[model samples]
Target: MAYDLEEQEQIDVIKTWWKQNGNTVLLGVAVFVAIVAGIQGWRYYQHQQTTQAAGLYEAFQGAVEKHDVKNVRGIAGQLMEQYPRSAYASRAAFIAARSNYEGGDGKSAKAQFQWVIEHAKSDEIKDAARLQMAGVLLDEKNHEEALKLLDSKHGAGFDGLYADLRGDVLLASGKSDEARAAYQQALEKMDPSGGYRGLVQLKLDGLGG
Candidate 1:
């Protein structure tokens, strides 16, 4: 049907408006689409990383269950190398270190502990690594070095263990007074019902405290 004069004039006005503003509108729409695409792409990348980390963790578990320390170390090394930013990698490094320690390879255990101490995102994990490393160093009679590592800022997370090891080191170094204080501090931080409480108390009494 043919439009009347008013309708014909309205159509001409609409056409003119589109011709003048069309490019800007299309450009705005394109920008919105690109932003949405970027967000989705980032989410997809994160999901992929999570999935890969999970798979690597499962492989580590399998090697552990088989009692294969060598295989565990190899797989855990790959995981840490490729996914160092992942929590799974941190956990894998800890487990691998423990496995190495149990298998009588203190050097590998020390390396793994140092790696976790330096690289873990979680402060709690880093403190735990430091604690273990200190214990190993003490066993090696590197008392001064162990003290330095244990001197790290563990805050409340490792108060008990730090105090206990510090006491041990002091006792070994024949600083009985400082040793007694450290043992007392350890006992105060420990659970009253804990078995270590009695041990600490005994040590304190032996020091004539």
Candidate 2:
């Protein structure tokens, strides 16, 4: 083909520009492709993890419902150990703790509760673990330790329950006046429409409020 002088000049300039910068452009494109691929790979891996964890969680639930303590411990332990980053792990810990507590294994129950308190990403779960652990300590007659556990900050929604548990610990320790005060705080914090308000009032009445 033939080109006019002006057209040839423009084509020459484009060729020169490509000769100087084409490698950099290709490198940039390659890097972008690698990054996109990497991101997709990571997303796939996370999805697989969540799917596997969910399956394990469902199995744990079945074990719990059937009162299969051995299977519950085994499956829950696997979830906590292998999938600790999953949401299922925290829930598994809670279920395992309750199961252990019910089966008269307070030591294991306390350990599982402590794991949830230490590792749970959710503040609500941690607060629930702390409250349950305090109850376990109270059952063991470790009054001071129970009180100490209940003394820590709980989630805003747990304030009333925390105060109520604290009152129970105080009452157990024979601190009647402090117990009454805690009961009053619980009542104040509790939502009037909540069922727990009635329970808290009963505790207050028991304390001669």
Candidate 3:
């Protein structure tokens, strides 16, 4: 009777273990399957975006080579709208901005530069956009706006150019003292090995600072 009771107890314990662990095993399988599906889905999305961005990049290059301002602008606009997050889109915006600027469409150039500044995925592109936008503003005699943009923190990489442009705008506005200060700042920031050092020195001489 004791042996029979012991066998019955073993059976009960096995049943309890299965009951507790079976559902957990099933849940684990489900979670693993979900993770695999998510990885595959992400890979597919990356492939699709890469393919689209490549095609757009090729078209953008072709348009640029053709030098057809209208075509370049249209294609760049479409590419940027369709693939805003793509690197190609940021490049296209920069190209389109230059095309528009050369075509005497300052308004469109400003818009394109603004888009690049706000949406570019890279800091280099953002800096380029900011500089170009400030230039356009200065051309349009929006001195205050241009100054604001030039005065923005562009870090060390862009300090020299930013200060130089700020000086130009200040000169245009007849703020000679401010212009001299900005020019001196630009000189201090410039690399001694850079080609612009001579030009900056010329500017300094003109300012008599």
Candidate 4:
């Protein structure tokens, strides 16, 4: 009888403890489940976004190939608006910019290039956009503006190209000595085995360096 009473007393203690802590435990479990669900949902949404963005990019490419400027712009705009952070958006902008430039729409080309420069997540893309924009400015004989774009930050890999463009701008602005220095810098920064090395050397030779 005494042992039965002891067991009953232990059972009562357990019930009291559960009554005090059960609610907290349940709340923790609920929070954990919600967090897991939220993470899974976010991942699924991101995958869907990437798939949609890629589809749009492919459509944009087809439009570009067909010289369908209206469709290209429409698709590119959608990508930029909906998936600005996606890699496809930046690539779309690049393609649009090149097509516009080739089709004699310098204004549109510059706008697209500027968008890439401002919105692209990749440093390489931004540098490339700057270089292309500088080229457009040079074609327009806006030497100072071209130089300004070249003066911005660039990656190490782009140093040679940036210097080359700077040389071209200087040369066009009647600064032969400065242009020679810029060309020499280009040759110094370029990879020894790069095809651009030979081009830079040829330019230097033409400049009597």
Candidate 5:
């Protein structure tokens, strides 16, 4: 309506500034909105994947409970192929590996263990997979490979288990002295009162350590 002289000048300056920079401001706002929406979409997609993987994992558990090794393996394959990034995928693979190992399918078990070693998100999971793989190798009489694998760096809390397995591999390989040393290390690293400690002690005693 009516503007003082100074007010009119200020308004003019604002109009000039808008004409020069309005398009840039609009573009920046649009890009920001797009980025925010993209982030929300990505989050939603991740949530959906986690939910679906959880459902599949429940099914995998049911099969495991029923001792349906075939179904367990098939579902594990699907989880691994479709939701490789999900925690369920690695857990499923771990279960499948154990199932195969127990069922005398060392080939499939070893393959799954290798997959976990390569793809597991958790250090503990990778360590467990490595240990199971060593067991498979020991069964196959691949003592040297098993020893080499056990020698690899393990995560915290796995030192004792690795040492125990190392002892087993050494004993199997006819290295009684080394086996005794490994078993002694296991006894030292393991929990003082853990149930497994007794077994390790027995092994050591068997070797007269």
Candidate 6:
């Protein structure tokens, strides 16, 4: 509210209020400044974490490309321990999982895949992790566990792969009819233009009528 500067009484009232409340007002200002500084500090810390995690992920990818499975696993473990929530951590885990699997370390591969499935922010990444984990289970000939993993909810785009893997599990379990149905469902889910369609068709043909 505006008052006439000529009002001496209002001026006197303002001076009295300020004398009583000035310290409280100053305290509020100090608190606001501290809060803003704290936010900036936190943001800077997060940026540093992300930058470091990214550098580590680059190193991990390089290791993967060079087929240095030991280095890949080491870097991935560091990321998981130090920056598990960072975006790069999950990606590093994915690469490391593949590396370990190819290196004949199925147990390490499963653990890394589980980490991605549990910690990845993206549903697509989680879906892919589950798919790969199921594949590992299939390789172990743990058909029931593989089927359970394959039957879990996945991304729509993953349906064909899920179904195909499911068919494999069923066939291994000695359920030819269920395997045939799953193979058919895989064909229906797959895109006709996809090169893998021919592979799935071959599987279906191999199953025979």
Candidate number with greatest TM-score: 5
- Score candidate 6 by TM-score against the native: 0.92
Worst 10 residues of 6 by lDDT: 1-10
- lDDT scores of the candidates, listed in order: 0.90, 0.94, 0.89, 0.93, 0.96, 0.92
Q: Give the alpha carbon lDDT tens digit for every residue of 77-187 in model 2.
A: 999998998889999999899999999999999999999998999989999999999999999999999989888988789889889989988898899999999999999
> Compared with the true structure, what per-residue lDDT tens digits does model 4 show for residues 1-209?
35588899998998999999989999999999999999999999999999999999999989988989889888988888899999999989888888889989999999999999989999999999999999999999999999999999899999999999999999999999999999999999999999978988998899999
* Predicted candidate 3 versus true structure: per-residue lDDT over 4-105, tens digit per residue: 888999989988998989899899999999999999999999889989888878987987898977778888888788888888888999989988998899
Residues 47-105 of candidate 6 have per-residue lDDT tens digits of 99999998999898888789887898899999999999997889889988988899899
After TM-score superposition, what is the CA distance of residue 195 in candidate 4 from its true location, in Å? 3.8
lDDT of 1 at 29: 97
The TM-score that candidate 3 achieves is 0.88
Judged by lDDT against the true structure, how good is candidate 1?
0.90
Candidate 1 per-residue lDDT over residues 162-206, each given as its tens digit:
999899988988889999999999998998888878988898899
List runs of model 5 lying over 4 Å from the truth: 2-4
Cα error, residue 204 of model 6, in Å, equals 1.2
Model 5, total clashes: 0
lDDT (C-alpha) at residue 89 in model 1: 84
Screening candidate 6 with a backbone cut-off below 3 angstroms (N, C-alpha, C), the clashing residue pairs are none
lDDT of 3: 0.89
Q: Alpha-carbon error at 105 in model 4, in Å?
A: 2.2
Give RMSD (Å) of candidate 3 vs. truth: 3.1
Model 4 misplacement above 4 A: 1-3
